[model samples]
Target chain A: MLNVGKIEEGFVLDHIKAGKSLSIYHHLQLDKLDCTVAIIKNARSSKMERKDIIKVECDVNMLNLDILGFIDHTITVNVIKDGKIVEKKQLSLPKEIKNVIRCKNPRCITSIEQGLPHIFVLTDPQKEVYRCKYCEEKCRQRW
Target chain B: MRHLMSPLDFTTRELEQLFDLANDMEQHRERYAHICEGKKLATCFYEPSTRTRLSFEAAMLNLGGQVLGFSDASSSSAAKGESVSDTIRVISCYADICAMRHPKEGAPMVAAGRSSIPVINAGDGGHQHPTQTLTDLLTIRSLKGRLSDLTIGLCGDLKFGRTVHSLIHALVRYENIRFLFISPEELRMPSYMTEMLREKGIAYEEVIRLEDCIDSLDLLYMTRVQRERFFNEEDYVRLKDFYLLDKEKLSLAKDDMLILHPLPRVNEISVEVDDDPRAVYFRQAQYGVYIRMALICTLLGLTGEEGGNIC
Candidate 1:
């Protein structure tokens, strides 16, 4: 068993698809943090066969969970306090997002403005399609 | 009522009412002449489009309203890095209603979000051109005396024609609207559009040659092969000559088949076809004015029936 010590206070990102933990770690900029962080890759799971996990010993204040949700909807965040799991946060796709995803269409005004905050609205929730609010360009998950 | 960003913004019933109003405006032009006597229209054209801008200006003028604003962005505060929001906010203070045309797909949408007055999208980048769609709808309604259960052929550049796409979007809601897309392989209609048609259970067929099925069409909608939409000049040259509608092409079409074009056409439509009774692009352009008048009136809260109270 590849068991890592539990965090006294922080968050554990679970159910990350295999090989995606590194991207999430970089996205959250966990490597630059002063706190202890561990990534368990290809961990066995009954539900997903194999998954990756991320654990941190300090709470990330600047972290945006919506980006994580937008990247992977199945990811779950578990908060730990006093060496015990306090709350389990589930992620769902956001209806509207600002400054997270960028519109890729070259002709879009957003592409030329550079200073304008990229905004997207979920037009089709069933299809997980988000269209740029300014350009009507479909935004795809980078990962 | 606040914005005309998309054709879907107006309901079918509202569209019928608008058409009725436009019909009345056409029949008795002088009756609604002073409807917008004191009002002002700001044409905030970030891009230069002669036909659309003129149509809007003419519509407001025909209603006896004043028109203002720049035809090009470089000539306005937009050249100094002012945001669309700021521009529209400023215009809203000066005008009763505004018509904006920009090169960006949703630039008008952003303006519509901030503007206090009604914002009509004149033509937003290859996106939705609601007014043009309205013009097309009015044309079809007037010419055919019907809006449903017809075979409409959309010829030439189906891929990048905003007019064709907008017309299809409006027509799909009608009872029986079957689309016949006639284009070469490289410029065929996008799959996203076809998928929408399939999802709606609408009948449609794609043909490489227009003459193959021209005889069965009730209306033939032609589009210019935009040089701007092409990546290379060579490709543009190759496809520019792809669909030439000369006398020979018209012979295949039915005698009563109406030919329409969102104009400023280059060479896709032969000049000889212009004199033919079937060519109604000029009438189509004239209808653009009436539709815009109806739209401007409706958006400004005038029901078009309160002729005496307009003053």
Candidate 2:
């Protein structure tokens, strides 16, 4: 059992896609953090065959909605008071988000030479297709 | 209002409004310059759709708006395994609206449900291409003055042509628009579209021969027999010849008859038809910009001169 030092405070991201710890770490920019952080990849998961885990020991206030939408996983944020979980929080889909991930359409206006921000709107929940406001293209697969 | 994911969703009036606005934008592009100023429009294309994507950027730019987002998926956080919902939720914060294209069916609809701002469906898989339908409508209106009472022959891969599928659905709104469906037996238009035509009381007929109805058609819409649809080499080679629209074949047609194609064409139509003065595919591509311009203005609620640029 690898000892992931107990956090006096902060969060524990659970059920990450296997081999995605480093990606998540880079996404969150954990290396630039002012708090102690620990990551474990290829960890056994009850819900998943294998998972990755990350523990952040700081009062970071940010929403990782991109992760929630990118993969099928769970994240748990806990506020620690004297080594006990004072508050436990799970990641939920945000109604809206900003500048987290890039659109995958190569011919999309965002892919042009101009300084345009690539965007998509969630239309269908069951299929997860996004519509481009400019092109009116509908795509179900996430890029 | 959340998204234009399908032509099925737009009412006749709403679709016409898009056309009307497109007409105005085409005649006077500079008039709508400030419609999207200070607002961000995001283009999220999951596939390689250069023509479709650039049309959107042109629409936004002509509207005096700024655009952003990624053309390639690998460059985005999605490669690192980001969820679609999370991605849009984040993008919604930065942009006032979005355009998306995906290789999978119904992906944009997923983003729209989670998004607060407007979502526009660019194209998805081999499914709906509503914007292309809009372009067709604008072209017909400009060239023929109306969408009704015309004999339109749809030639090529009916089963796999997304534009053809969408065009047929759109034509249902017009009165007395007869259809001469031309395609190989294996590539026949889907039964659902036929059922839809029947339910809507639109008249149509399917024929394997394009020349049989060439002289009778007021418009001939051509598409490539998508080679990707055939499993065997023998089937593709056999069916490929059955749909070619050459100028010699056009000589048997009416001079007033207009020919159209949702371009990026293969060998379906002979290049000789380009000088026939009836080929309207290139003009059709330009209308794409006009139609999209009108759509952006309407969707963004920039109807007023101030919103669309007064000075």
Candidate 3:
């Protein structure tokens, strides 16, 4: 069995759908952070059969997990401290997300307006539907 | 400051107050004439909707306010690649309130986000036209004496009719309102709309022919059926006549039944029907002015007798 060392601080993202860790990594903007990070792809899991895990060694406050819940709330977020799991953080859909996704509707004002932030607002929590703030066009869930 | 982006932006009670103010304005136009005397209205039209632009201009003029701004994107700073946000910020300094019409959906919303003064969405591409919806409500209320407990038959191009969709969204707030959607199968109301009505527990029936439910409707709203909407020319030719509202079709409706169409219509409604007392689309345009006047007053906080307090 291959083994990876645990981080004394920061987060351990677990049970991400297999191969989606890179997307989460980019979405969380981990590449922009100066920290030690490890991405485990297609890890065997009894719960999910195949999963991905990402461990980051940095201050807990450095990570912005707002987009995590929107990406996939099923993925578990564990806060690590002193080489042990400190707390499991819960994730919920955000009311609004900015520049996360672009509105694809050609008639949308964002298509022509300069420097307008592409914003998606969560209209239906149960259905997991996000619509563009400008045009109210439903965002196609790519994730 | 508040901006009118959608009809649902205002609650049922607020709409009632606005309608009441409109009714008061209709009854006593002279009393509210100079309410906005020193105020200036900037009409920023990114598209050429002469009817809507004129209605807005007339509404401002009726309110004793000055009117300014561009009628087309080419004439405005937008021609020089100026953003809606920047144009509205500049307009905010020049006018106390602004009404905008854009070919792009939600352009006014972008402007409203950055605007210092109140903004009213005149019409945005195929999106919400709140003032038009307000005018329909006011016209229905004025002529029929009520907004609820009526069967409204919306005919013609239901799929792409922004007015029809907006009217449905606005009318669903009233009690005992039933919808009769009349359209060709090719241009039927979108599933999302029917699903919304179903979810809200509102009663609605979709029929292919206008005559199937014409007699039962208390109000019939008509929209143009475009030739481009169909997959082929044959279907457009075959279904075009079915949607046209003529005197013969008007005979099928109740004597007191009101007919409405968002104006600048192209042959969907016969010019012969214009003389019919039941055909109130022209009067509906007049109500457009009153509703807009009331809206400008409400948004500019001129609803109070002293003109400083909001309603």
Which candidate has the top score in lDDT?
A: 3
- lDDT against the true structure, per candidate, is 0.89, 0.77, 0.90
Candidate 3 local lDDT, A2-27, one digit each (tens): 79987888889999999999998899
Q: lDDT, candidate 2, residue B218?
A: 95
Steric clash pairs (candidate 1): none
User: Model 1: per-residue lDDT, tens digit, B1-311?
Assistant: 47999898889999999999999999999988998989999999998998999999999999999999899989999899888888888999999999999988888888888889999999888888899999999999988999998899999999988889889999998998888999999989999899999999999999999889899999999999998888899988988879988899899888888999999888889999999999999999999999999999889987568643565
Q: Residue B249: error of model 3 in Å?
A: 2.1
Per-residue lDDT of model 2, residues B1-311, tens digit only: 54788876778888777787788778877777876788888998877789989989988888888899888788776777665667789999999889988765556766787788888888876766778888898899888999889999998888878889889878877888999898878889989679778878888999988778898999999987766666788988887767677878999998888888877877888888888889889999999998887777777777644444445
Give me the overall lDDT of model 2: 0.77
DockQ of 1: 0.54
Give the best candidate by DockQ: 3
True contacts kept of each: 0.62, 0.00, 0.96
Off by over 4 Å in 3: B226-242, B304-311
User: Which lDDT value does model 3 have at A101?
Assistant: 79
Q: Is the docking of candidate 3 incorrect, acceptable, medium or high quality?
A: high
State which candidate has the highest TM-score.
Answer: 3
Order of quality (lDDT): 3, 1, 2
Candidate 3's DockQ? 0.88
Model 2 segments beyond 4 Å from truth? A1-143, B228-234, B304-311
Better candidate by TM-score, 1 or 3: 3
Candidate 3: tens digits of C-alpha lDDT, residues B156-227: 889988999999999999899999999888789999999999999999999987777899999999987766
